[model samples]
Target: MAKSLQARKSELSDQEMQLKILSGGAFETGELPTFKAQLSKHKIQTLRPKTFSILQLNIGYMCNQVCSHCHVDAGPDRKEMMTRKTMEECLNVMKEFTIETVDLTGGAPEMHPDFEWFVEQIRLTGVSEIIVRSNLTIILANKKYHQLPGFFAKHSVHVISSLPFYKKNKTDSQRGKGVFDTSITAIKMLNKVGYGQANSNLKLDLVYNPSGAFLPSDQVALERDFKKALKTDFDIDFNQLFTITNLPISRFLDYLIASENYEEYMQSLVDAFNPTAAEDVMCTNTLSVSWEGKIFDCDFNQMLGLKSAVKNPHISQLNQNELMQRELQLSQHCYGCTAGAGSSCQGSIA
Candidate 1:
């Protein structure tokens, strides 16, 4: 195992060199090969026929911020929100499938005009779990939405916020300056609403991606640091810390290619492949849905615009039996999931 980790690091070292040279060796710690390699492992390709869960619903593609590593490539440019009629179709389909969970995603899923109506309808279904991937800052984006924390609490929805880091500087660099402050505030709000408190029925999960470019430090260790820091200063408490690996797709892929970090990152992933993590990958359960109502095994495939080649690729026209029987799409980026400790939307798969 030690030798394998070393080999993986060495492979990343080569990519790190290229990435550094691309910017005249100005690459920061986040741009390092080790981190890039870590991000590359989680392919998130789903096994349809064996799927244990279904990720239904897409609010649309409209966001308040466009981060450097955003896989969605979302911004003011995206105008493809799910129409009310389309959402009704989704709800109709939902009644037919025994989907254990509903994972709602988008540029800013809440930005969709019909987002509330959709969520309310889903609430009626009372699925086992409801997950909403939020940017944190959005909850406090405006007066109307400022009360979202309360709404989420009322519906007993699980909240997943992308904080990037507990530190101000690193978070600002990847997301945007001042984003750290807003995110922190948002967390505190959720904490007030009982989202992150221990033993609280409301489940609150915080997501951590690499800052510069190194695989995340130990998840247990990082969680400790965040707990200590947020508690002492911000008085915020949260549940599990999910250490996700970034995938080489969309904006991040462009960053790597333009900065010449592509080959190195790819090589690093191939070397660090871990067999154990691959077996328990998120694709075993979760099904990712895209902005235009498209379906993928996971979010990574959605970033690359890789659609299901299965019998029923589009979620609107799903064929459960056939989709279940089809083989998943494969790509070089899959190494990210099999690397040391592995990675997935839920954090370290290993």
Candidate 2:
């Protein structure tokens, strides 16, 4: 019986492993390393990262489209969502901190029923900057969201939209088919509202992540190529290009196992660990809040169900004095944050 079961297990294929990882959960196999160990190997501190002047908030975990590589694994099925009441609590807490920036993110942040209202409320505050990380295609996913560019314009939001790559094949391969076209259309609309052009008050930034198994190329070089290619081939215009690394998490982990690239990707990241990037990690300056009003050290940990240190736990029960004194959680996956030139939502952290 033991031999028979062993034989059956040996017959399991890559696709089989992927299905198990995807449906039952990635941890079912226990093959992947923990988030903290990965960070420690790279000499990156997985500890209480300092709170800087900026704050990056995850408004909710619910999103309309389920992309193939979404680190958060956000989609229509997700029930852990943020409510208006909780958002009000976040707003209340916002008043206690001297933060100059409030960044809102989500499955599709704009999909939040009160997304516009939240934006308006944040706008009313004297925060010096507002950054919205958007999946460009979401802007044209439906008619109701058609006027998003104008809304962003009104708020003067610093738009960081993901394009994966300028080529249709690459972008669609990672995100989804037809995503490239929709994203292009959204950019055109943003350009009309002064998004990417030089000297344009509307700040439009493009985010690029490699399609597979590697860290992103240099930012300045990639940005130049993107600008020239978009202008010549697609007649598109945008501001700075941000290069981000695709984190190993959620659906992406499933992809790695399915494609037989898990080991390769992990080893690649470990090989390219960059010390300079460690000094300016996003978590050092930004605080991340989950959909249910829980505080996290960073967005990555929030996705992994890691909560803030003891002094501050639940956002709903936030105490500014307590939060200011607490330490942070750390993990192995943080290697992705400091590898190579380093990666954050706004490109290289170093």
Candidate 3:
């Protein structure tokens, strides 16, 4: 019987284990071309930042639920949280730089003690967009969180919640039992607060991740089906649906290995590699900040403990010119982003 990597933390908590698995095996044996080689084949010498528009912060790693597909592997037992001082460093960087968007993520970013204060501070920075990646069920998880809908509306924060599927069974299977119902209720609360309402500016979007070791279907088609189904069945309304591919890392990687689907899934990604998608990968435009303020090319890289390929790779010491010039840190997991239509926090990029 297999268990989660975290469950066997004593045995496999080392980040190197995951990295070794990704870099070794087929990748090491030449069964699959390395990401660098693939890029060279397409004349992409190096993947570097094109802009510094989005600052995505992973505030903490504590969550109320442990979703099987969660790349963060966030759960209640995880205690890694960002300190207020570190957040202050982040704020300083925000004030120093012209950030267009501030995206908050975590086990559940809201679980952080000073999450609201952090948002208020970001607002003070005059960032044009503030995106909170909520898990949906968290909005209804506790009595204190019951007012999250109104709170989000007050700040005009863009709420991007995860809803793996419109149906209850599929959703619950990926998350947990009754998560779909709670999420639906939470959506209604957001709708009541003017979020996702027709013609309303309080934007509310839902994310869709494939429940298994497969790439997500067409974003447009999935969004259409989601809108029609949610509207007809529960009168739910949301701005749009973002279909994201599950990168092989963290808990999802555990699932792949445990289920003997690792090689097959990696092959699928390689087969569907799109150079256009590779060109537009999120790492090219977004900077990921870990809970402790370390910088990475993207959130997935942050999870793998891969810091940015620049000197002094910390938010406190962020240098716009240096970051723009830094080449991306790549691995087999990157194939997930370039596969098919390409996946990013904002859904398909190509």
Candidate 4:
């Protein structure tokens, strides 16, 4: 493992470098409490799947901006993408299983060549919800994508975006130079299409992740602060704020290692473990599908190459019952989900 990590250090993209550091056992201090033991102490003998309802499809790892803490390590250089064949398989899974929500993610899911086509196809299946996890700035990324807001509104697509902070310096420091301004411009554009309006059915939600090695503040309180600030400052209105805990993986793990705060941060997650939150972790209901068709317990596990604990790890190989019967692949990174109020794509669990 050490030799492999050393080899990767030479040409590893920052994203792969972090995963290598983790899989190489460089970040496991042995001093922190094991996540499973925490479960046992709280009488959770086993973590099992509740149902298979949310189908999260990662279209590809291509993105326009390289954020400091992106778990996918997606940027302009990534070449891996989902083909129409794989997407057809995913759509079949959705139809056969009657999956309630179809979650679309990516470096910028919109960056996928077949993204819009995929959404159009999924809508025809009559799925309840189609969520597009966007980076916000992508709406203003290029002239070709200018029509995205109206397109989303026309389809009633639920939009969830990343907004690190309401201020410029904090947001720019984490995302990149000029990203904050571009994001704000994108928000206004969405508003023009009724994305954040109160009476509009269009749902526009924002996600906030801490910029450093710490758990996020309360979701409800932070949402209040965000609403007041965005309204007074930019007249922006959105449905909700999802405060996500930064998992110790990918670029975030790199930041923790470089800053010499890895041990402390790991301990922080361990100390905040909530059994109630453990019961509702997103993995219990959602199955994450990689760009190439591999299935995972969740998006974080997808990044770490922790495939589902089933015989067949790809979507094309497994049926719905086989998926729900599979156990989750857990690791130290899971502490991010069970810590504090607990975190998921939706927000706090407890």
Query: TM per model?
Result: 0.84, 0.86, 0.98, 0.94
- List runs of model 2 lying over 4 Å from the truth: 1-46, 319-325
lDDT value, residue 242 of candidate 4 = 96
| Candidate 4 clashing pairs, residues 3+ apart or interchain | none
**Each model's Cα RMSD:** 8.9, 6.8, 1.6, 3.5
* lDDT (Cα, 0-100) at 341 in candidate 3: 93
- Alpha-carbon error at 13 in model 4, in Å? 5.5
Residue pairs in clash, model 2 = 35-331, 35-332, 35-333, 36-331, 36-332, 38-332, 39-332, 48-328
Q: Which candidate should be chosen as best, given TM-score against the real structure? A: 3
Tens-place lDDT per residue, model 4, 1-350, is 01222124523344455455554443455555577767778988778799888999998988888787877777777778999999999988877886899999988999998988999999999899999998998988899899999999989999999998888888988899899899989999999899989899999999999988889989999999999999999888889999999998776776788899887888789889888899999999999999999999999889877889888888888777777777788777888999999999988899
Worst 10 residues of 4 by lDDT: 1-10
Ranking by TM-score: 3, 4, 2, 1
**Which has the better TM-score: candidate 1, or candidate 3?**
3
Residue 128 Cα positional deviation in candidate 4, in Å, after optimal superposition: 0.5
For each candidate, the alpha-carbon lDDT, in order, equals 0.71, 0.75, 0.91, 0.85
